[model samples]
Target: MPSPPYPVNADGCHPDKGWTQRQAAAWLVQEESPTGEVGFVRSTAGFNGPLCEPLTVQVQFWRLTYRSAAGAQARGSTGSAPDYSFTMAAMKHVQLRVDGRRDVVVTPPKGYYSSHPSPCVGGLVAFYTGGPLTEKELPSRIVSGDSLLTFDSADFHTNRVIDSKLSSPSDPAVCDADGKPTRPTSAPSFPAGALLPTPSYPPIRLNPTHT
Candidate 1:
């Protein structure tokens, strides 16, 4: 499995926070892939269980342009909102990839929302606010494990955003582990919005086909 783009710190910083251009280049060459696809896979158990009731799946992709000491481009899911924003800062632009389509720059407010910079790092971030399942939507029970829940780029933006907010920023922050930002105790709240009709659940089975 591919690791998320963020670091593992609470605030998303690390020891090697500021890498020299040569270091960044070397790291990029060894650590990051230039192009890739990411998405969530519903677990067979979740689909069979009650937790799947309100959940929906979505996949997102962004064109990453890295700047600083070294510059490069890559394609992959932003993981979650904060992760999207964190990933965005290193890149010049982003294109939303959903349902097998490419080069879809999501229109903000309708498709997503750019949010306040995290207190730890002043990086710009964004999340999906629209959809049948807004951030407010909650599951009846909590599921766990690689088998219980899979989150990549393709799940509802709300889920992506919430997951990012809940995730350790250190997991994605460009800085090294010692220099990553401190994690936020309280997650940022979602803006007010109407709840769109929930997407219907796809066939519940082990390894259901994805677009």
Candidate 2:
């Protein structure tokens, strides 16, 4: 199965937890396609009994295919231009509204906020980039955006911000009594207003899906 974009458990825990092909085969029924391709089969599938339920499931599919565990992703080099290259830029000073006060993280001029930046900020944000193209610096640029979404610090911090915002137990408006998100009244969102929720324990360290 394809990896989830969001967390699965109430604790912002992922049921898969970086399960490998062999490990996944232990929990799920593995099958070979007519073309000799290995995949998870829905019918007579293998899964842990009383499988942990998902807090939110987005875009369910009947079958999920993969070229390999991790598909091919191109990586570019530094200087001398190739067919494809990735330009690198460092973040200079940034301006934000902290608790309704205008706060700017400016250095002598174009310098990065080397300290830990706050997760929450509001109002105008000026992302000054592009200074001088050095091994570090680049030209000056600005990116402006309003609060796209908000999360409780606890919820936002859960699983490095990949946690679930909605309670795992079904919401009647979103699901039938059976616990399905048939018509969700409100989807999981970063806690918008005041409340900030934190995870109870330190989250587990997950391995990279690809070797």
Candidate 3:
């Protein structure tokens, strides 16, 4: 985890409380799906170098809650009922790497307990190149692997492999255009395009004659 040069602000946090930005960033972990796409999770995420550098990040789903801990603890802890006053929103806040670090930040409403996220669910969140720093999108919710990415820069101490390199899933299977769960929540998009593969089909055995 890299030190985010800024504060990790939340409802119950104080100016004096919280870990060093590096420590907090470390608390954010990633669980790579069997396919090799990276899912980043930390209270606060940061990016270095220039904003002009092209980069695309996909946020599958997230929760924002004000709970009593240095970071979000998702297991063995049950959160209270949803309260709108204490907003636990999934936001992708970006600014120029050197110029306007403090220009953008969202302050959640006061009077909340800790980081227990909302029960509500939303679609994939993303920040694309050339878009406004404060603006983001939920282009598609389905997860796929149409490309392969490798981290070859010397800035990295060790080589890294990103198996399924996807810019953004062009078709959404779980979410809608606005990041909301679509109606008939269990149904798949019609026409059955390659981008939207059906999951319920029976498995096929290849090379059955080999034996």
Which candidate achieves the best TM-score against the true structure?
1
Tens-place lDDT per residue, model 1, 9-108, is 4322322334343432222111111122222222222112112112222222221211111111122363212222222211112333222111222222
Better of 2 and 3 by TM-score: 3
Measured with C-alpha atoms, the lDDT of residue 170 in candidate 3 is 24
Question: For each candidate, what is the lDDT?
Answer: 0.25, 0.22, 0.24
How close is every model to the real structure, measured as TM-score?
Answer: 0.19, 0.14, 0.19
* Residue 136 CA displacement from its true place in model 3, Å: 11
Q: Candidate 3: global Cα-lDDT?
A: 0.24
The regions of model 1 sitting more than 4 angstroms off are: 1-35, 45-54, 69-211
Clashes of each: 36, 13, 7
lDDT of 3 by residue, 1-211 (tens): 7665443344222232333434323333344442222343322323321121112322222222111222212222343211111112332333222111122222211211122211222112222222332212221122122224322111111111111222222222334323343434442322212112123322111110110
lDDT of 2 at 5: 39
- Model 1 score (lDDT): 0.25
Clashes of 3: 7
Lowest summed lDDT over 10 consecutive residues: which window, candidate 3? 202-211
Per-model root-mean-square deviation over C-alphas = 22.3, 24.2, 19.2
Off by over 4 Å in 3: 1-93, 98-114, 122-127, 133-137, 142-211
Candidate 1, residue 200: lDDT: 37
